[model samples]
Target: MSETGKDEKKTKKKGKGLLVKAIVGLGLVGSGGGAAFGMMQAGIIGGEHEKEDNEPKLVRKGEEDPYAPASKDKETEGLGEVHGEGGSEYRTSYYSFTEDFTSNLAHSDALIQVSLAASTRRDGRVLLWTKKHELAIRSAILGVLADTPEEDVYALAGKERLQKRLTVAINKVLTEREGFGGIDNVYFKSFIIQ
Candidate 1:
């Protein structure tokens, strides 16, 4: 073949090869993008549609809670306390730990003991979870107490901060276990430092 013709043919083949490669690359990219979009729509990738099952919800004073723990005594079935209209619209429930938490103070020989109760405005599932996970909650509480400074336990402001920390600790445990933390406040039912 003539030199110019041979060179032209080779250039044409190279051009065709480049075009095919470009098309194949574009096709692969399009397929990947489509798959990712499908996964997101199906909730397999992004968590936009993901939701907790039967998450605890706030209970109004007169509203019923389907998730509330059933009363063991038939006599108490209709004996629930009536809430007044003056306070919060939501009903508050309390869960008291059965045992006291005793731990040595941080960086001191002094010891502290406390009996605590947690409150929640949500349904009774929170209380039930608290009772069920009391062991883990107690451990978290003791860790906080052991880390608390001795002087902090004596001051009112420091005590308030400690309460907040304890509340966070309890909620962290509950969230890790049950995917939700409903504790509103942590009350010091009894506090003693020795």
Candidate 2:
């Protein structure tokens, strides 16, 4: 190895290293520009997308429901003035309990099962509240049914009274959980004694 040969080899190695660094630097600049372009397209940074309609359409105060049926104010449609004081025009809605209630009667070993449904002449919010608090409501209904006498399951009048009791129990639950109780009545879809 001569001195000139060693110097020439070192110079060539330095040139190769500088070329690789320059290529890497150019690659880094290109990728950075691409990232910036993407950010602008996605409206994350300032660009021509400045006036993009990305704001949310939140429900403001006093805004009416978009899907509700249009009708006259203060007057319920399809429900005009009644002739007598006995009857009033009102639409009734029913919500059936998802599961049948089965429990042992208080005084006897007999088991009673009742599939119940609640009626409401109010708005659909009552139904939504019923569904939301169903677990609590079912617990209350089962509590009443468990204490029911075995004899009450037989007589028509006794059953009627039981229905009234059940209605009161459910209304109590609704009133406790929600501010209002809109339940009109609770009827037994299927009542069984065993």
Top candidate on lDDT is 1
* lDDT tens digits, residue span 42-108, model 2: 8888777666432222223234323222453432222111123334355555677778999998889
Candidate 1 global lDDT = 0.86
Q: What is the C-alpha RMSD of each candidate to the true structure, in Å?
A: 6.6, 13.2
How far out, in Å, is residue 1 in model 1?
Answer: 40
Whole-model lDDT per candidate: 0.86, 0.72
Model 2 pairs in collision: none
Q: Write the per-residue lDDT of candidate 1 for residues 1-194, one digit (tens) a residue.
A: 99999999999999999999999988998998799889888888975975647789999988988767677453222123335677898988777777899999999999999988888889888888888788899999999999999999999999999999999999999999999999988989899999
Q: How close is candidate 1 to the true structure, as a TM-score?
A: 0.69
| Candidate 2 residue runs with Cα over 4 Å from true position | 1-88
After TM-score superposition, the amount by which residue 9's alpha carbon in candidate 1 deviates from its true location, in angstroms, is: 34
lDDT of 1 at 24: 97
Structural similarity to truth (TM-score) of each candidate: 0.69, 0.55
